[model samples]
Target: MSRTLQSGYHRPRMLRHVGRFSPVRIQSMHYQSGRHIRLLLQPGRSLYDALVRPLQAIGVTSASTTILGGHFDHLEYCVAPPDPSGKAVIAYSSPIDAGASFMVFGNATLGKDMEGRPLVHCHASVRVEDGSVKGGHIVPQASIIGATPISVLVTALEGFELRQAFDDETNIPLLKPFKES
Candidate 1:
């Protein structure tokens, strides 16, 4: 409907995967309610352990968490770019270190990996040790919390679970909601 389209100009090629597109793009499930918890990421713990251990202790296996602004002794992140191998639409790049970073903001999801292990997928904007501001997918396992505890608000999903499974449409493993098993 834009001037380009109305003028019959061809659009540029869209970013897409090589796999067959699935009809169900938005996968969803219902839950009666969610438990809210105020979690503190203890200092010196890996972001993954800090986020996963406490939640796991409380019987929360799946959640959406808001990570409050704070600092980290070390941080690493990865950007997603076009896959050279063409195995999927895009792939995460190798971890990039953002040393002694200050997390401006972040959000994370706790789920189970394809192998049924805990997975913490997080994205954040941070000010690195060099004072440059950047944002990308945070590498929780490698990032260490700073001296002070960082707070997080957790909304624990009930009656269902989030699990990573292979998606044919994008030819990647993705987290999706499924009935509790």
Candidate 2:
């Protein structure tokens, strides 16, 4: 209680938002069976295609994945900063190109978009050619893998599905777990 009050006082600022308050913070669920897949993201292919196509062929439409360290011929990522128009908390900057970079690791959530197609939301840390390390949201489709193959551990969610629906709280289309309909 004392620590919380001190921290609040130190900040002396309350972040303002443009939306109404909501009761729920974290919406989560569990499954009795977790389907696992050892996916190999082939070299010389877009990260999106490498992950999506093979999984699709196996009839896996939704999952959570961890991308192991690998290389990419051309990588594009974005940094999140304060929103310019104050519409929301933050917005992604223009895609930043990291030429011939090496991906250290990554976490991605696969879901269906509003159009009912595949969508991958991924954030990764990378080691750039200049020896600098950075992490951010990855543009998977635009990122082409290098000659070395990358491995990914995928946990497919059975019974239910993941969908990117318009989240009124965030005022964004975020991936949310849902019951299969």
Candidate 3:
């Protein structure tokens, strides 16, 4: 819902999540400098494999990546909406297919899940073949790269790592930076 102001501007209502508020609103960590990498996403591979395999080869497990414009043979993404189960604040909707789309840009976070395996959380804007523009969380494993190599700029985090742990306030597993054990 939105309210029109006297000044002729409209403001949308802010939706509150059904969860206990946490004292720590933003969970973040920082280092002196971040290691950078110019990565190329290879064609004919899942975005997950294209990112994880190469970065792991160089021992980079935790980082943030920016995916510059690129093409995909197939792409699927999901939007987040209020959770009906009350288990978490929000939940990802079912994957929406965007066939043969061109990725306008994307920001991805590389981390380790509870199982200690590589996990990539990526959000992107895409242009579908039919000329519709949409943006949402990208499904890396389902999205296949196109013929040309896609460029990605990676900022590797050092001294600390991002790990998914159960967040009590939100009652969800979220990635937070923690000092290396």
Candidate 4:
């Protein structure tokens, strides 16, 4: 009868996920050393090709990149909202175009997709054609680099690689740090 009713009220414990519980959390890896690269995104090429091809040539299979501000002939991005069907935690919305845009800054994690192909997961803030600023996940393959080249700082994860693994906690295939294959 001495319980303090004012400060700590009795509340039911709740579980977050719609699916069953997962035992594992925070799967991570470490590398002896990391490689760094200064990449110039080629002009007149898609953001995807500009970033991917050059890195591929140098045997850089996995990396985390920081893209500095630059111009884009055209750009597109998508936002992630709650999943309506309860199948996944969230889903990407339809592409929103920003014609003739200027990229402000970006964080991109590169890894292999489920099909074992290179994938770039990029998110950025940009100044659109209308002079408005916005931020979201970029559709790199569709985004065309402008006349001037863009610079990117690449932190290549060596000894281990990054690949998309199904995350039960989030119910999504997200890029995760993994051992080199």
TM-score against native, each model = 0.92, 0.91, 0.91, 0.88
How many clashing residue pairs, candidate 2? 0
Q: Which TM-score value belongs to model 3?
A: 0.91
Q: Best candidate, TM-score-wise?
A: 1
* Per-residue lDDT of model 2, residues 1-181, tens digit only: 1443433335455665657666888888778999999999998899999999999999999999999999999999999998898888778999998888999999999989999999999999999777799899999899998998899999999888999997776666889889996
lDDT of 4 at 175: 88
Residue range 29-107, candidate 3, lDDT tens digits: 8999989999999999999999999999999999999999999999999999888887776899999999999999999
lDDT of 4 by residue, 39-133 (tens): 99999999999999999999987999999999999999999887898887678999999999999999988889989999999999999999999
Pairwise lDDT winner, candidates 2 and 4:
4
Off by over 4 Å in 1: 1-13
Quote the positional error of residue 146 for candidate 2 in Å: 0.8
Give each model's clash number. 0, 0, 0, 0
Native-to-model Cα distance after best TM-score fit, residue 157 in candidate 2, in Å: 0.7
Give me the runs in candidate 3 sitting further than 4 Å from their true place: 1-19
Tell me model 4's lDDT, rounded to 2 decimals: 0.90
Model 3, position 69: C-alpha lDDT score:
100
> Pick by lDDT: which candidate is best?
1
TM-score of 1: 0.92
Which 10 successive residues of model 3 have the least lDDT summed? 9-18
Cα distance off (Å), candidate 3, residue 124: 0.4
